[model samples]
Target: MDEKVLLGHGSGGTMMRRIIDEVFFDAYGGEELAAGNDAADLPLPAEGERLAYSTDSFVVTPHFFPGGDIGHLAVCGTVNDVATSGAAPKYLSCGFILEEGFPMEDLKRICQSMADVAKEAGVRIVTGDTKVVNRGHGDGVYINTSGVGFIPAGRVLGGQYCKPGDKVLVSGTLGDHGITIMSCREELSFRADLKSDAAPLNHLIAEVLEAAPHTRCFRDPTRGGLASTLNELAEQSGVDMVVDEMNVPVKDAVRGACEMLGYDVFQVANEGKMVCVVPAEESELALEAMRANEYGTDAAIIGEVLPCPDDRSPRVSIRTGFGSMRILDMLVGEQLPRIC
Candidate 1:
């Protein structure tokens, strides 16, 4: 019960749970972080294989958006996470928190959207739960989705597997989701027609893995976007990385909006884009596989990993088109709230 809590330490034991209950619950009567799990395989009765599991909660302000809704996002987010571990997502459980007096028609629409996207992704919603909160208590609706998938035999992928000479590839243009959400908000309304890139990447990932069997890892840049994701990878692999600014695919509208609003495009959130790190030799194979997918037509190989001396700390830097380099640091604080 006397354990110290860090920023990213998920509560899986009594210590962090105690802290949440004591501090958070005492203040709000809710312990949100009492339990959580990362995207990793869970041990099961099966011997030669394992199942990858991941869970996510969606509370996007605008229940509906240009490209997707909360229900669609809930499924894609969790599915993508499980897939990053080289698993073929199969089943999902959805839980909905609906506000009293919420429109049944909208609820029905969101549910249908979930079904459509789920079917498209080749996954099933096996079970679900629903609860209604007081009229003013809940925001229209919130969804939590948990998924599991079976990892193929003899397949292992993770950031820790990255090494020098690995190539970095992005599924498509960045910041569309974050910027789209921003443009949709009524409070700070902006004129843009960007759509949320919230789509299941399981199939695309499957193809990439098939083509590039030696891939180091796959990461969907969500809340903290590509910069944070790459920083975490660099630290995990203990290697340096050099990303070319011009090589990264950021849509013109997104780039312009970020420039005008003073936001780092690299730090913008993405719901449907994935970051892939593979061996230099098979990088093209990975690129080809990604480009073949509908969601990854704009995929590009943006950078390469470099050796980091034992005495020097690993770093991620970006090479500008103007012949200069600057450190690409991880996002420090919340850039946008409830972005995913």
Candidate 2:
């Protein structure tokens, strides 16, 4: 109680139980969550509606940073993950791993942030778990979140839904989240301000679905940036992608950071944004829907799905601003490690 927590907290014994009961349970009070099970038995929604579920973990260093913190990141990450599946996010369960010596006030702040984000996203934090680790055994805090949502009937979205001539669109500027976290962790200074674009994107996805229900796929370019996400789409759909470098929106601050660090913005990570693939004919309509939303005011059409040049494997290609073309491969290993 004097210190934050020790390794015994994660031992799944008395210490862990105490942390869960005393801290987590006390913060998120409810009966559905009191069972303390790995998977919650959720009630079904009204007939004809389908359910969407998603899970994600956050390990961003410097738990507190510009634009957002681990609490917001954990909530939005899972909410967007479920939203990308073409669902209206409804509920979330959070798990926390705390390092010894961490401040209790910090833990309370993080929980409050989570609650605020959940309320804003129109979702609820139904249940959660907590554990602690030795001082040197863990970072300050790590959060894992899982979310559930309801998808309307007759609506289908998946990687396989992509086809030649589909359009690729991103909600707003790229690499903001990765660059912001990098600057804070490295203590880098710059003329222009940079902040993480961590946010809940369920609203944008929901709007796009309403305007154009035929979207092929929706994915947030996190961990592995835009290029990596396109690569995933190509591999999944067996179709190549042609992107225009000039069409992709990247903030000046982010570009500057990438240039100085020898990092590719397309290969960096993002938290609050999303990429949507829609049929070519409905691309304009989808753009309108996204642009109307605050999170996607700068939304742009960056590329199109096409028949792979190689008959065997699909890949992503970008027409550079210089008018040359280049293959956009997946980010090797970890592009920005420890970046949510």
Candidate 3:
């Protein structure tokens, strides 16, 4: 570890893992915290009870972007984290850090966005806090959200639950949110419409769980996109993953933008997407249920879990469109900074 922190520490890759293990976990970890799932599954005061809890901070630049703004991102980010643990997100608490001289109108717009998304997701913003910093000390605004949700009985989902023969599925297209932010940040002009796929995914996930009760795990591919998210799950489950590149969906506009900008769509960020793992036998049923939901119309089975090869660590590989296979590793550094 270095004497001070670097932006790479927040990139959700190797550095982030080191910092968590050496700093946060070293100082505050317990049995439950050490598990390091997206959300903490805590036992309620009453017997035979558990709840999912998660917190996240958003610092996306430009604040407002195509399809959604920071406010919408903040709510969906936390809600999806809790929901990924197979919980029904119910309540959230928001905290705001505002730079001095920030516009009141913009703040009102953000608050309204939060309210609207909360209502749509069936979650409530029950409490919050606000702080102000000097004009140059902070961005125009940064938002932190914490959420709690109830885990339904018989719903035990975690990355470690995956095993060989399980199938991998992704919700909708990739790189929409990241490409939208990149286009806005760089002021890139394109004829095709590009928008962030930012929306609450709790409802879509609920439908999938109902149809595929034997689902092994759920993960929202946020910071490091689908590649990193799948790699993490593969390592956690001690299994290898073989993904079909042709089956993975990427919007034409987004793909073009990524090519023009030298960005890998698989390594970009997404606000309203999830990677689901379920038994191979239930893959088709899970796909059907996901497609029935508005947010998951593009859901597809992209891969399958495989037993780890002898003398090698668990990893992820993609079968390219050209009949070649390549290893897909986690993002080494920040691809698009301030992306949620």
Q: Spell out the clash pairs found in candidate 2.
A: 7-134
Best by lDDT: 2
Query: Candidate 3 lDDT, tens digit per residue, 95-131?
Result: 7777766665576677778878988999876555556
Runs off by more than 4 Å, candidate 2 = 1-3, 6-31, 34-41
What is the alpha-carbon RMSD of candidate 3 to the true structure?
10.7
What TM-score would each prediction reach against the true structure?
0.85, 0.92, 0.86
* Global lDDT scores for all candidate models: 0.83, 0.87, 0.85
| Predicted structure with the largest TM-score when compared to the true one | 2
Preferred candidate (TM-score higher): 1 or 2: 2
Q: How would you encode candidate 2's per-residue C-alpha lDDT over 1-340 as one tens digit per residue?
A: 5355666777879877776676666665566768667766777788989989889988888898888899989999999999998899998988887887888768777877887788889987887777777788778899999999998887788877789989999999999999988888889986239888999999889899889878888999998899889999889998999999999999988898899999999999999889999999999999999999999998999999998766479989999999999999899887678888
Q: Count the backbone clashes (under 3 Å) in each candidate.
A: 0, 1, 0
Give the residue spans of candidate 1 off by over 4 A: 1-47, 186-192
lDDT (Cα, tens digit) per residue for candidate 1, span 225-316: 99999999999999999999999999888888898888999999999999999999999999999999999999999999999889989999
Query: lDDT of candidate 2 vs native?
Result: 0.87
